[model samples]
Target chain A: MGVASTALPRGQTVPLALRWRRLGRRLGFLCGLAVLLSPALFVFLWMLSLSLKPDVENTAFPPVFIPTSPTLDNFREVFATSPFALYGRNSFVVATAATLLSLLVGVPAGYGIAKAKAHGLAFVVLVSRMTPGLSYLIPWFMLFRALGLHNTLWALIITHLVIGLPITIWVMMGFFEDLHPELEEAALVDGGGIWAAFRDVALPLARPGMVVAAILAFIFSWNNFVFAVVLAGPDTRTLPVAVFNVLTFEQLAWGKLAAAALVVTLPVLLLTVLVQRQIVAGMTTGGMKG
Target chain B: MGMTLTSAARHPGRPARRAVASYRRRDKYIRFALPALLVVAAVIVFPWLYTLYMSVQEWQVGSDRVFVGLDNYANLLRDARFHAAVGRTLVYTVLAVTLPVVLGTVAAVFFHRDFPWRGFFRGIFVLPMMATPVAIALVWTMMFHPQLGVLNYLLSLVGLPPSLWVYAPDTVIPALVLVETWQWTPLVMLIVLGGLAAMPTEPLESAVVDGASPWRVLRDITLPLTLPFIMVAVVLRAIDALKAFDTIFAITQGGPGTASETINIYLYLQAFSFFRIGHASAVVVVFFLLIVALAVGLLLVRQRTKWA
Candidate 1:
């Protein structure tokens, strides 16, 4: 139908011009998106090629754009030679723990701040986030050393909380503002306390927003290298820091590094796809109304 | 303002009662705000203050702390490496901010209208932002590998010699910027897309009816409407870009002759690798000032634009 509408619009000159204009706009939009997306697509396809190629073929001069002898050797190596699974498990524990902790502190905090109309407190949190990580890194470095907490997972989780908590709280503040206070008030009127009102009414309704916040926070904590790098002993190193070790130790294993990179990203990719809607909704919600 | 709020809330006959009530409320706020404020101050403010104090000292690994006031800052001022990091950081920030904003705005506009495969396309485009930075850096490192990497492979296909990418001092910052822009452009796109999605359709419809070209309408209508959202994205991303450490650490560890060592990486090296805690603290203090200046400047610009 679209093609027919654009095809000369038989016996109607005016309609034809309008139809052509619309067609032009559609074509332009698609082309623009394709151009914008090329960099992402290019890198993705390249990684796929490297992941599938065998080790020798990976280094073939005029390097193999496609695997002629595709194998799982690199993935197998990533698993067998290193503690890839252990690192992945550690990442999961740290990320999940950090996200849950942030939500615990941040959700109530976000609610209290928003309900109380504490814009000053909100601004204070923003300023805390605005302070570069290094400012805290130095002092915390000293404090953790003095406490003998250096190179411990506890240090990693706590330091990451500082980074992830504020962002989660701030984002939740926006989510909380969009919610109707009437629901919580209704719960309170039924003799529910503040905590109960949040638990049964606000929390249930805020599931989508919470999911978005949790996923983003988890992804960030999972990917955080600085805290993990500084605080994690070799026994506790997370995947990101582990992958970084590849650069220093394995100068020749490009394929293995690529495979390791893919392994690290697989979980976040799945989560991003799953929560894509909530995230995009959360981001664009305010602007569309204003 | 406090007095006015209390007066407005009070019955005319109860003015004195309201004043005392409001004073109690103010007292309550001061009380409730104290603990949170203390946590923030200890976690944030004390570190910064310590950084300032340590910056002036000449302490190093196992060395006596010499009270060298202003020496670290002075040394930084004369240091060529410090100058290079500052220059590279500014360059990276500008490109990373601008390219993403412009491209993201365009994407937002194009995707604003309904179309076939719209949902699929939207999800696919945001995939890069979902992919962690280390993953993106690793993938790009492969693509940029001088030998046996896809980027070089493609270059060979085009009859061009392969480049060293991160290893080449001249190319390191640009290479880092490329990876960053790749990872973050989707973020800018998502924010702009939100802004575009939120924009009212009436003004745009009227502009079209009045025979404004799409470009003119975009400039006068859509651009102005989305300026706040765009500013928010730019400022927030500038903060992150200024503190960029992850990908650089993964790919180069700020090496290949200090080509990619940002201020954040420099601070890390000083405090941890080199154990120049005092000097590193000074660098952190300086870096904080730069970030504060950028944030304050942006906020002021935003306020002025709003008021105007």
Candidate 2:
């Protein structure tokens, strides 16, 4: 297809048979892409349809793809019956706090590691990231109770650091590694101290990286289920836990459940759509380069 | 280089003094790393040490703790459920990793070619992975419904009988893995697409000029060049798959019986559900070892395949 398009001169016309064949091939390619994309598109669309339709239509025999009369009752019902507002607040607070804290700690660490060639320290951070969350959860659960911090957002915030901090460090490490060392060195060669060099030279250049790291950290922290499920009190439930609760308590209420799920996912979904390129870049760099 | 030139030109001598000053500066910078390291140590290192400590003692909820060194580990050996969970976890991980890697590579190859609306389609493709796992799981659970599900409806439309998806023990793991594959295959595709984008086109163009078959070119050149990226995808998918908890928990909660229960589910039950902290800690230790071993092994393989 690429060859056909690029090989042809702008003023030249293709033979009739070749043009027909090209059209056929283009259609085939579109079909293939659609087939590959169907599952992903269908799943989300189906959920959306479920959330829109009435209860009867939701569980209809053939399953309704579109509601005869689309309604917002399911979403309204969700807010009425559950403390989704509180859950949203909890998720926002925890995710924001965790991201900020991870940045404050991790960015400097990443810069230091890159500048000082502290491969051993970087490896430790990587290993810590790779360690299963459950391993830490058990100990943290015990420690939290011991320290009388269980069921508090403080407990949740600290635990989420394990997720956010590693990512911030890894992403920042990659960013710092890519930076020209001479910029900081030049700053140092001047009257600037190490702190000034970092604060003035490296930090400004790393702002985009910080944004990427912060977004990723926030997303992961927001999406975290296990830590919140174990550590959160009723009043402190995050969105995932709140959604899970809807599932448990309202098993057969498919519309309400779907609505709840969509509500919980809406923020991250919006973020994903808005900054997918950054997310993909961050994920690959953080995963592969680490 | 410029800094060094200017500094040397300014000083004319005392290069040794400059090196010492730079070394001192770097030493000071290393202190900036200490806060993060200390935080990680407090959060990760301390917990791991405590887990190890707890693993040696029998500490059930609402009871005095007693030292039972190695007993929990011994029990794990003799325990059939633990064995089954381990087996299930491994099988699940293999399916989860292999399917996504294969499908993703194929998808990446397709997406690498020119097509209309390619970027838009790729964006749509990655949605499942970025969506909250619990939400995706809930949606999949609805789709996996044997009677009312769209899946069964679609299957019936194709003249096939409706089958039990996540409800039946015999078919549960694969069914659950299907959801996993659906969600994660896009991730692998994205990673491999990156590799494809970064790859040199010279070999492929030359191979085409040599009249090499497309299949032959792909097998001998493209696959080999992308093997390192695929290995990276494998390593990541394996780690995440082994520790997969959210989707499985939200979907089947380890299933109709114990069929879908992987090591993670078992560990959750042991700790939170059963409240046997010691046993769960032992499981945690074993699980951590398993992950580290696999990671080290995969990293070794990845290193060997680092041709690019």
Candidate 3:
């Protein structure tokens, strides 16, 4: 199907059989891709529709795939009943702080690891990530309470860094490893110190990695729940925990839940799709595990 | 951004002055590393040490604790709930990882072609991953409703019976795996797609020239070349699935009689809900060990496979 210019003796007309076969293959390929992409896309579209519908239509039989009379009532309820704006603010602060913290610490760490070829040091970073959040849950919960930091954004930020910093370090290590040592070497020959070389040369070259790391770090922190649930007090509760809070009842408010979920996810989704190529790049570098 | 080159003896030119420069550079390296290491020590390492200590002692929140060495671990050995959660976590990880990888690889291979709107479609596919799991899970829980849900309505439109998803005890994990696959298959797809994009095309082109079928070309070339990426997908998905808390909590809360309770869920319940801090710490240590073992195994595979 990919062979657009197959060798077919210059003067010969195309064979009907081969054209039909190619057409069939193309159709089949399109069908396959559709089947693959449908579930996620359809579900997202469904959520969107659900979020827009009146509560009467939400649970109606012969369900509303699209809202006939679309309304903002659910979104209104989402904001009115809950302190969603406050939760959003908390999430923003926590995630941003986590990202900033990751950058502050992880960049230098990546530089050292790359320059020294310290695989073990990189592994140590990975180990922090590789351990499940639950492992950190109980102790952090207890210790933070002991230290009177339990309900504070500091605790949330610090715990969130456990998720973000490793990713930043991992992705940045790969970027630094891929750098040509000659750039730094040339800077050194120019009588510039190591700091000048790194700042003027290596760091500038690593801007893409920085963006990728920051975005990935922020996204992970934004989406995090366990740490927030275990450590965050009401004042510091982030969006995921807020969303989870709305589901505490056995009987769910699907409309409000859908609204809250959409509200919680919208920012990250837009940011991701807006900078998808970098997200793709970041994920692979961080995911493929340096 | 100051990089400290530590290997001074390996440098070119004068040895004497270079030694002083190298010493300064080493110091800078240590300084650069100090902040990150300190934070990790204070946050990750300290908590881990505390968890280890807590694991050995019989304790709970708001209670005077007794020092009961190895008792928590011993209790875990005899605990049926702990065993069930561990078993369920393994099953969940396996199912969650495998289905997504397989589906995602196929999607990736299909998308690697030069089709029109491929970028648009890929973006659509990647959207699910970008969305928060809490949102996805909440939406899915609604969709999984027995009645008054669009899914069952859609199934009825196709003349099929509506099925209980994440509701029935026997089918709970499979249903949760379905959501896992929906949300994460795109991530695996993106990873494999990256690998596929970077792959050399000569073998595939040659395969095509040899009158090979598309399946043959894929089997003989694309799949083999993408094995490392697939393994990456496996390792990542396995890791994420092993520790997943939000989606499971949102959708099922490890309910329908603990049928879908993974280790993370069980640990959360033990620690926070039950306030069995010592027992939960024991679970935590065991969970950490399992993660370490899994990670080491996957890293070995990556080593053996020689992925860049």
Candidate 4:
């Protein structure tokens, strides 16, 4: 009671019925998020501006927040000079394939662990997830080279699955544990086998879990850089690696790089924003009850 | 086929049932596990074992591996760069974790109740985490461009001269830190927001009734209750920060000097670029041990808390 009431910001001098403080509270909250969010927003605005400005204005002494004359030339240059479209396609395909593969492996793994009540296996999986990607990259580089799969799209997809699968399994394990077992049991009692019970009963209930897993899996795989950097060849290079390649080719092409960055960032950014409410709910549920 | 026939002949119905049941279990195990085991073995388990083997050998590109146990580990122990990398890694982790928690929690508390544009703000702030870090790094690198960079452009507004950002070794780590914080603070914000939303409001209400101030309530009540979630954020961020490479690689490439080089970057260069495979493996082994120790420490703390 003390804590809740205290949080409401009341003063003895001001009457309890005064509504000004509530208005102040709302303004203060908005202000707080503004401060918290400005750094990121500034980045987006700056990049957007950079993408528009001509190369000369890009280096103007007082950096222009608004391009005096915005141009689509940088966008045109990106397409004309680089394999940007191909890279986008590659990233999309690999991310999608990896997400699907992770779901296939992860759902069952999560289910088994949840059913068996194996915290040890869960911990083991988390440890694997925690292991730095680079720690495994070098050896895998050698292994993939030996297998002649290095520099292939297959390698990028598989490597991303390493990132995607564990999170899917971990998050879904927490989710599955929260689900009622009675549904599956009822299906089994109705002459369904374990597979059929899981497919028909548990799977439907697990839709939200699947959505959360798929979203997070896609995001991680799509943004993955280290794996693609090491494994992808010229033909298989993903967007991030492709952008990095451009940076190397023309050092400090600020205008072009910003344009390219924004182009690549827009799709995922929009998707993340659209699903953020569900994502937050998923995260909260997983964290609180896992 | 032979076993089934033999079982049918030996014990009729019961033996056949037993044979089939065991076979089914075996088949399930083999079918479900073999492919997974093979993938994991080939990808994870094998590399780890191979890295251990590599660490004890005098191996380099195009050279036959020769056994030289402990030398690589000894070399890493004596290497000043390794020591510096360890220090940088810790500093990066501490700054990255602490700043986000404090700032994120404060924002979360302020925004705990309903407010206009809350969803929009939350969604936009989380944009950095969703986009590729490398791409963000690329953009920020340009933003930090000595003359053309927005950072300096802003600094000039405060009557300060333009400063080198990515170009200076001293500023490199801090620059990377800023980028990391921008990207990850939203994540912490989400966690803290969730924690705040879930918090019992009754305590705060009673505190207000007793005429206690907002400051007092936050200090005496809210912080203590949200400590566990904050700790979880710290642990997660620490692990991620320890492995920070992509953004740094994209931005400065551990440059101006090795100022921004974490253990991961050090290992990457030694193993891949220079082909000091043994030394790199040794570095990885040490890193692995450190992470294990941290995980164990967290477990012990969790157990102790439960005990209490």
iRMS per model, in Å, is: 6.6, 3.3, 3.9, 7.2
Fraction of the native A-B contacts that model 1 recovers = 0.44
Model 3 clash pairs? none
- Lowest summed lDDT over 10 consecutive residues: which window, candidate 2 chain A? A1-10
TM-score, chain B, each candidate: 0.83, 0.90, 0.88, 0.83
lDDT of 3 by residue, B18-119 (tens): 566655676566555778899889888998889888888888777889999998999999999889999999998989999989988888887787888777
**Model 2 agreement with the true structure over B20-88: per-residue lDDT tens digits:** 776777788798899998898899899989999999999999999999999999999999999999999
In candidate 3, how many Å is residue B36 off? 0.9
Q: Per-residue lDDT for A265 in model 3?
A: 92
lDDT of 2 at A207: 93
Candidate lDDT scores, in order, read 0.75, 0.87, 0.83, 0.78
Mind giving the per-residue lDDT tens digits that candidate 3 earns over A88-117? 999999999999999989998888778766
- The top-ranked prediction according to TM-score is 2
- Tell me the TM-score of each prediction against the true structure: 0.87, 0.94, 0.92, 0.90
Number of the candidate with higher TM-score, 2 or 4: 2
The candidate that achieves the highest DockQ relative to the unseen native structure: 2
What docking tier does model 2 reach?
medium
TM score of chain A per candidate: 0.86, 0.94, 0.94, 0.91
Kindly report which residue stretches of model 3 are placed more than 4 angstroms away from their true locations once superposed. A1-19, A250-252, B1-30, B298-308
What tens digits encode model 4's per-residue C-alpha lDDT throughout B141-257?
888888667788788889898788879888888888888988887777777777777788788777767777667878998887787777666667777788888898898787877
